[model samples]
Every structure is written in C-alpha cells, then in structure tokens.
Target: MALRKVLQQLENYKSEKPNRVFTMYLNTDLADQDQQGGEWKIHLKNGLNNFEHYLQKDGDSDEKRNFWAVKEKVENYMHEHQKDLKKSVVIFATGEGDIWFSERLQMPVQTAFHWEDQPVLDQLKSLNKQFPKTGIVLTQKEQIKLIDAELGAVNDTTLYELDLNTEDWKQHQGPHHADSNLGSGGVKSSKKDELAERFEENRSRWYKSIAPKIDQYAKNNNWDAIYLVGSSVEVDELERNMNKQVDDKINKNLLDHEEMKIIEEVM
Candidate 1:
C-alpha cells in the first residue's frame, strides 16, 4: 500500500480507537529462513491464512477483499461474548504469529526481543518506560532476574510487577496436559465478524500467534481471566483456550488458590 493510504488507515484507526490497542511483536527465531530479526513474516502469514478461512461467513466466495469490515466483525464477537472476551488489547508474539505491524496503519506497540547479548534488564527497563501504558510482558524468572535490579535504592517490597510461578505444586501430581486439539487448517468463524474479515483480507500473513507463557500462566494458576498485552493476535488465542470443549490435565501440579492468585496479581 502507498504511504498516504497507510497513513490514512492509521488515522482512521486512531480516530476510532486512540487509547484501545491491539499488539504485535518483533522477536527472534532460530529455525527461520531469515533467521535474524525474529522472522516477523511468519507470524503475519499465520494470521492471514487463518483469517482467510475464518472470514467465511455464509458461503461467501470472495470475502477476503472486504478488509474494511474486519473491525466490526471482531468487535461484534466481543460484544456478543463480552463476558469471556475481556475488553483489553489483543496480543500476540513470535513463535506463534509473525510480525505484520504497519505503523502507518496502526499504533506503536510494546516490544519483546532477546538482544544478541546485552543486559536484558536495562533494555527492558527502558522499554517499560517507553511503553508505560501497556506495562511490560516478560517471562516469570526473566522478569524477576532482571527487573529486580532496576529497583536501585527503591524499596524491594514495592516490587509487584513480576508474574512469576511463585507457588508450590508439591501437592499436585505433575505437569498438566493442555487440551489444545487445536486445528491446524480449515477452521472458520462467522464471516459477519471482524475475525472473518481479517482472515479473508489477509492472505499473505500468519495469525497463529499466542503467548504460550500466558496460557501456561492461566492454566497453572487456574485462572478464569488473564491479561495479554502484545498484539491483537492474542485474542484469537484467548478464544481458543477459553472455548475448548474438554479439559485436559494441563498442570497436574495444582498450587493452592492463594499462592496462584499471587501470580495473577502481576499478570
């Protein structure tokens, strides 16, 4: 798309939602064609293909062209299932989804990248400051290992940011099995939805992105709700995890509610 067109789209997006957000990530992956820069294309392709099939509403043959209709579809889905879909930004990261972020067509997003070899703590702290509204998303141990140092002179007791696995699973059996008999292909949502529009409109990107760490957190903590602040791709995952038909032994190591709630506090 032309720069002007992209800018126009972004302006529309901003006018429609100045504070609300949908997130994406720029991550690194080892087994990718462009091994460097996290191969964001992979994530973009995932969403595109998934959305293509997802937009098939009522036997429509060429619904993908209706890119403008995507927002309404997604919003309607949330509206209908407002109870389950927490009215928060949709988020996604690498390994599950590719990065297809057009700054001209969207807003600035929180970033998560493991630099080649730098003090992740300082980098993350700087990023935290840059994206103050979104907060920061990092692994449990990573958050603790690095972030704790940022509290230089600051009281350690005030540190309530890390979402670490701070519970004892000794009482439970073992690792829990996740019920993700998730579809690999040919999955569709109502075409009348924004999800449908996204799938239909985006044919050159990936959308299979979801933060497994977040899912694990939810499963490990037995949470009814959780927050993901990365990309709109996360919402698709939230639906997948939340709408599962059956339950599996995802986390056999069941921690006490009180202990698990501590994890939830930061997540």
Candidate 2:
C-alpha cells in the first residue's frame, strides 16, 4: 500500500513510543576519480546555494536538498520512536566526505567547502563495536537504488505511490538519471558497453561502502540475513558472494516493467 507522505507519517510519530532511537548513515560518493584524503566535516552547506527547487536528473545535483530530505525522514522516524531518541545519534554519510546532516528540520548551514576523504572500499573490522542502535540512514544514490524490494515494496496501493513518485516520470529515471552529466543535447544514452562498465564500478564501491554496515547491523541486531536491492546484474552479482547473508531484489522492478519507455519514445 501507499505509505503516507512525511507530514502524515509525522502525525503518527507524535502518538508513538520507543525504547531507543539510533540513526546511522552509509557512504556512497567515493566513485569520483581523484577523491580527497582525510577526516570529513559534518553539517557544511557550501554547495547548496544554486538550487531553489530542483530534481535529481540530467547532471546538476541538488543532493543538498536530498540531504535535507534525509533529515526530514529521520524526524519522521524519530517521531515514530520518540521515546528513544533523547539519547539517539542520527548519522548522515558521503564517501570522501564523512559529513552527516543531523540538526532536524534545520540542518547546519555550511560555512566552508571541504572534500570527502573516506575510501569506498574501507571497512570497519569491528562489527558490534562500531554501531549499536540505528535510525535514519542517509545514503548515496548508488546505495538507495540497490535497496531490497521488500523494503521498498508495494503490496497494494503502493503501486499508486510509485506512480506518484514518478508523476512526471521518465525512463531509466533512477540514480543513473540522477548522476548523469547532461550537456546541451539533453539526456544522452551511454553506449551499452559503457553502461555495463559503470554498473560494475558502482557495484564494487557499493559493496565496499556497505560491507561494514551490513556486518555491523547483523551483529547488532542478531539478524542472520540481509536484503539487498540493485540493478539485476549488480545485485545479482552481490548475491553470488552473499548468497546466505543477503537477499537481493536487484532490478526486479525494471524487468517486470515490460512496457519499455525509452527516453526517446517518451519525449
């Protein structure tokens, strides 16, 4: 079914209770070539001056607002578990940037510009020691795109929700649409071979970024299994390695989407 919007969810949170609220963020932007090196600065808004209301498509990234959205979701989730958040920690993430947005409705405005330095493949060796309880998980495009279907599934009215999500829908309008660098020609298609290569590259980085979080989450929650979502190929590959520990819903949506809507056709 269609989950209500954030405002509606917030209303429910006010009436809920919790034992504890724990929030954490997973990193994803390390794919950029020649990334930085060092610790990160959290709560900086240096790159948000450009957009008023922009969508994440055709190159120009308004992920600053995306970060703000993450904050909104956290507030809503915290409201659901208000009894526990008095001591909860909300985490936001970026690959080279260990920056996380946590100030609730008003994220800390940035006063300086800094680069992210975290390695994409870096993993925290200690699972239980790293994270205890968790809340909002701020994430990268790559990470969210690969989320397990069950987590973002629609048993009934959710189909309507997905339709609404893509109201001014376009084909392939997932994270790739969000990341593509568009020039004057508008959205351009990469050669299929190139697309394949990019998928592999992303899958590699995603695993690197999520491995520790997965292991840590499992150890903390006593969860013997994990669900994964991704492109049919990428998540499929991920399943090969974590067949027992992870459950994948990779690209199942796209495959079921037999009525193709290539951008050229939609336009």
The candidate that wins on lDDT is 2
lDDT of 2 by residue, 1-267 (tens): 111232133223211111112124222122322212211112112132222133234233444444345445544554564433221222433322223333221111112222122211111112212321211111222333221111112111111001112222122322232333222132246554554465466555544444454444345433323444335665555455442455324343332221112111111
lDDT of each: 0.28, 0.30
Q: By summed lDDT, which 10 consecutive residues of candidate 1 come out lowest? A: 145-154
Q: Write the per-residue lDDT of candidate 1 for residues 1-267, one digit (tens) a residue.
A: 222232233334421111122233333233334534434435444544454455455344433333224433433443454333211213211211121222111122233322111112333234334322211121121111001111111101111121113221111122222221122122344432643454445312221122333344344433322332222343333335443222211221122123223233333
- The regions of model 1 sitting more than 4 angstroms off are 1-65, 85-87, 91-255, 258-260, 264-267
RMSD of each: 25.5, 22.7
- lDDT accuracy of residue 250 in candidate 2: 30
Model 2 per-residue lDDT at 191: 58
